[model samples]
Target chain A: MNLQLLAFMILSLVTLGAAFKVITARFITHAALYLALSFVGVAGLFLLLNADFLAAVQLLVYVGAITTMLIFAVMLSQVEEIRQGAAEEGFWRRILSARFGVIPLAVAAALAGVILYLYRFANWKAVPVAPDPNTTRSIGQAMFTTYLIPFEVASLVLLVAMIGAIVLTMKKEDRSR
Target chain B: MIPLFYVLVVSTLLFALGVYGALLSTNAIRILMSIEMILNAVNLNLVGFGRYITPSDPRGQIFAIFVMTVAAAEAAVGLAIILVIARRYGAAAIDRVRMLKG
Candidate 1:
C-alpha cells in the first residue's frame, strides 16, 4: 500500500515480464533487450534490499556488459540460418509453443508451488530489522579484509576465462597456405 | 518493515522462470541468458538474506559480487565457444553441437 510496496510490486512485475519476454521473444536481439530490462529491474530490487553496491554492479555488469555482449554474439552468429532451423522445428513456434513449452510450464508451476509451501511452513531464521544504512562501506571493508582470498580467486577465475575465451575463438584460417 | 518473505518469493519465482527457460531453450545463447537469470535469482536471494539475517556484516553482498564476476567469466567463455560452434556448423542450436560427443 505504501511507496516501498508499490515499487516492489512494479519492479517485480517489470522484471518478471521482461524475463518472460526474454524466453518468448521472436528475435534474439529483442530477447537480449528484454534481458537487459530484467536486469535493470533486478538492480532496483537490489536497491530495495539496501545493497547499493550490488545494484551498481548489476547495472554495470549485467545490464551494461552482459547484455551488450549477448547482442553482439547474437548479431555475429548470423541468425538467418537460425530462423530457418527454427522454422523447421515446426509450426508451433509462437510465444508459447506447445511442442516446447508445456513441460516447462508444468515444471515452473510445480517449482513455485513447492517453494512457496516450504517457505511458508519452514521455521525461518531471518529476523526482520531495519536495514543497516552503511551497506556500501561495510561491503567494501569485508571484501578486502575478510574475504580477500575469495576475491583474489574470483579475479583469477576471470583471468582464466579470458584466456579460455581467446583460445576457443582463435581459429587461424588455413588461407595462410 | 518490508517483509523478507516477499523478496524471497520474487527471487524464487525468478529462479523457477530461469530453470524453465534454460531447460526449454534450444538456442545456445538463449540458454546462457537463462543461466544468467538463474544467477541473478541466486544473487537476489543472497542480498535479501544478507539484509535480513546479518545486516551488520556484508558477507552476502560480497558473495553476490563474486557471483557476478564468475558470471561475466562464464558469459565470455560460453559466447566464445558458441561463436566457434556456430561458425563451424552455421547454426546455433545446441542439439547440433555434437563434435565432442562420442
Candidate 2:
C-alpha cells in the first residue's frame, strides 16, 4: 500500500479506537481526554483529505476548546455516583444489561450496513482530483465574498449561544439582582 | 490520492459509533459528546467529497467551517445547561432529570 493509504488506515484506527474509549472509559475525565485524542485523529484525517485550513480549525476548536470545556464540565459536575455504579455493576454486566443492551449496537450496525449498501447503487461521481494547496486562502476568500451573509449569521449564532449559556448558568442571586 | 469510497466508509462507521453512544449513554454529557462526534463525521464527509469531487469550489470547506462554528456554540450551550441540571439535581444523567415528565 502507498503511504497515503497507510496513513489513512492508521488515522482511522486511532480515531475509532479513541472514540470507543470515550464511550467506555470508567472516568468521565478520562473519556474527555480520549475525546481529545479522537479529535486529533480526525484532524489528521482532514490533512489527508487535503483540508489544510479545516485541519487547523479542527485542532484549534475541537482539541483546544471543546475538549477543555468537556473536561471542565466533567470536573464541575457530580458524576462520581454514576462511576461508582458502573464499577459495582462490572464492565461486561453493565454493557450487556437491558438498559445498555444489544439494541443500540444492532441499530448502529444496521445503519452503517444500509448506508454502505445504498452507496453501491448511487453514482457519487467522485473523480480523483488534487485539492488546492492553499485551501486556507481560498476558503478565506469565499467566507468573505460568496458566503458573507451566512458567515455573519454564524457569528451571530455564536454570540447568542454565549449569552444564553451565561444566562442559563448564572447564580440565582446574580440573576435576581 | 485516496479513494472517496474509503473516506465514506470511515465516516459511516464514525457516525454509527456516535449513534450507538448517543443511544446507549444515560449521561447527558456523554450524549453531547456523541452529538459532537456525529457532527465531526459529517464534516469529514463534506471535506472528503470536496477534495475528491469538487476541488475547484471551496464550498464544502466553507460549509464545514460553519458546521464547526455551530458545533462550538452547541457545545457551550449544552455544557452550560448540563451544569445547571447537575447543580440543581446533583447528577447530570439524562434519566435522573425527570422534572419535565408529568
Candidate 3:
C-alpha cells in the first residue's frame, strides 16, 4: 500500500473511533473532548490530502475555537458532573436504539454504491493546471476577487449571528427577578 | 487490493454514522459533534477528488478552509443557543426543548 493510502486509513480509523466515543460517552465534557480528537484526525487527513492551508485552518478554527466554545458552554451550563448511577438506567434504551440505526446504514450503502458506479464508468482525466505556490495567497485572492460577494455575505452572516447570540443570551429583567 | 473507491466508501460510512448520531443523540452538543463529522466527510471527498483530478490546483484546500470557517461560525452560534436553552429549560437535551411542538 502507498503512503497516502496508509495515512488515509489510519486517519479514517481514528476519526471513526473518536466519533463513536463522542456519541456513546454519557458525560458531555468527555464527548466534547472526543470530538476534539476527531477534529485533529480530520486535520491530519486534510494534511495527507495536501491541503496544508486547510489543515492549519481546521486545527485552528475547529479544534481551537469551536471545541473551546463547546467546553466553555459545557462548563457554564452547570452540568459538569455526571449524575450518580445514571448510566445503568439508560443502558437498555441505548442498546435498543443501536438496533434501530439500520436505516442510516442502508442509506449509506446505497449512496456508496451509486458513487462507485458513477466513478467507475466515468472517463475522468486530470485537468492540467499549475499548482499555486502559496495556497493562502490564492485563497485570499479568490475570496477577495471572484468570490467577493459571497465572502462579504459570509461576513454579514457572521455579524447577524453575533447580534443574535447576544440577543438570545441577554437576561430579561423580568426573568432575572 | 484497496481501490480509491474504498476510501470514498469509508468516508461515506463516516458521514452516515455522523448523520445517525446527529439525529439520534438527545444532547445538543453531541449533535454538533456529529455535524462536524459530516463536514469532515465532505472535506475528505473534496480533497480526494482534488487528488484524483487535479493534484496541482489547491482549490480543494481553499474550499476546505471555507468550510472550516463556516463550521466555526456554526459552532459559536449553536453553542450560544444551547447555553440559552440550558438557562431556560435547566436541561440541554433536544427532546426537552419542544416549545414549538403543537
Candidate 4:
C-alpha cells in the first residue's frame, strides 16, 4: 500500500471509532467530545483528499463552533450525567434498536448490489488521474459560475434555518399573567 | 493494485454504522453526531470519486464543502431545538418529545 492508502486507512479508523463512541457512550458530554474527535478525523480525511479549505472549515465550524454549542446545551440542561436505569425503562429503546439494526443491514446490502452492478460495466481501458494544483480558488470559481443557483439556494436554506432556530429557541412571555 | 473497491466498501460500512447509530441513539445530541458521521461517509465517497474518476473538475470537493456547511447549520439548529425540548420536557430523550408522532 502507498502512503495515500495508509493515510486513508488511519483516518477512516479514527473517524469510525470516534463515531461509535459518540453513540454508544452513555454520557451526553462524552458523546459530544467523541463527536468532536470524529469531526477532526473527517477534517484529516478532507486534507488527504486535497480539500485544504474545507478541512480547515471542518475544524473551525464543526469541532469548534458546533461541538461547543452542544456541550453548552448539555451543561445548561443539567443532563450531562445520565441516570442509571433510565435507558432500560424506555420502550422506545427496544424499538429504536430493532429499527437501527435492520437499516444497517439494508444499507450494506444496497451498497454491495450497486458496487457489483457498476463492476459489471467497468472499462479498465480508461483510467483517470488525480487532479494537480487542487486549491480553493478553483472550487470558488466553479461554485460562483456553474453552480451559482444551487449556491444561492444553499444560502437561502441557511438563512431560513437561522430564522427558524431563533424562533424555536426564543422564550414566550407570560402575556396572560 | 489496491482496487478502488476497497475505498467504496469502507465508505459504505461507515455509512451503515452511521445510520444504525443515528436511528438507535435516544439522546438528541448523539443522533446529531450520528447524522454528522453519515454526512462524513458521503463526503468520503465524493472525495474518492473525485480522486479516481473526475480529475479535471473540483466539483466533488465543492459539493463536500457545501455538505459541511449544511451539516454545521443543521447541528446549530438541531442542538437549539434540542435545548428547547429539554427546557420544556425536562429531558432530551427522543421518545419523550413525541408531540409530532401521530
Q: What is the TM-score of chain B alone in each candidate?
A: 0.96, 0.95, 0.90, 0.92
Q: List the residue pairs that clash in candidate 3.
A: none
**Which sequence of candidate numbers ranks them by lDDT, best first?**
2, 1, 4, 3
Q: What are the candidates' individual DockQ scores? A: 0.68, 0.69, 0.47, 0.51
Runs off by more than 4 Å, candidate 3: A79-92, A97-123, A126-133, A174-177, B1-6
DockQ of 2: 0.69
lDDT tens per residue, model 4, A62-164 = 8898888877777766553232213534434554565655665576567656865675577644355654655678888899999999899889888988888
Best by lDDT: 2
Model 1 C-alpha lDDT per residue in residues B7-76, reported as the tens digit of each score? 9899999999898888787888878989999999999999998888888778888889999999999999
By the lDDT metric, which is better: model 1 or model 3? 1
Candidate numbers, best DockQ first, in rank order: 2, 1, 4, 3
Which candidate number maximizes TM-score?
2
Model 4 lDDT per residue over B1-102, tens place: 235566666677677667777766666777787888789888878876775667677878888878877987897789778877777777777876769632
> If you assessed candidate 2 against the hidden native complex, which CAPRI class would it receive?
medium
Task: Report the CAPRI category for model 3.
Answer: acceptable
Model 2 lDDT per residue over B1-102, tens place: 677888999999899989998887777777888899999999999998888778888889999999999999999999898888877887777787888632
True contacts kept of each: 0.70, 0.68, 0.43, 0.52
Residue B1, model 2, lDDT: 64
- Deviation from native of the Cα of residue A111 in model 4, angstroms: 6.3
Off by over 4 Å in 4: A78-126, A174-177, B1-3
Model 3 lDDT tens row, A1-177: 487778778888998899888777767778788888988988887676556777888888888988887777776666432221123235236646545455545665576567667767877674554443566676688778877887787777778877777777777894577
Note the Cα lDDT for every prediction shown. Answer: 0.84, 0.85, 0.71, 0.73
Cα lDDT, model 3, residue A18: 91
Model 2 earns a TM-score of 0.94
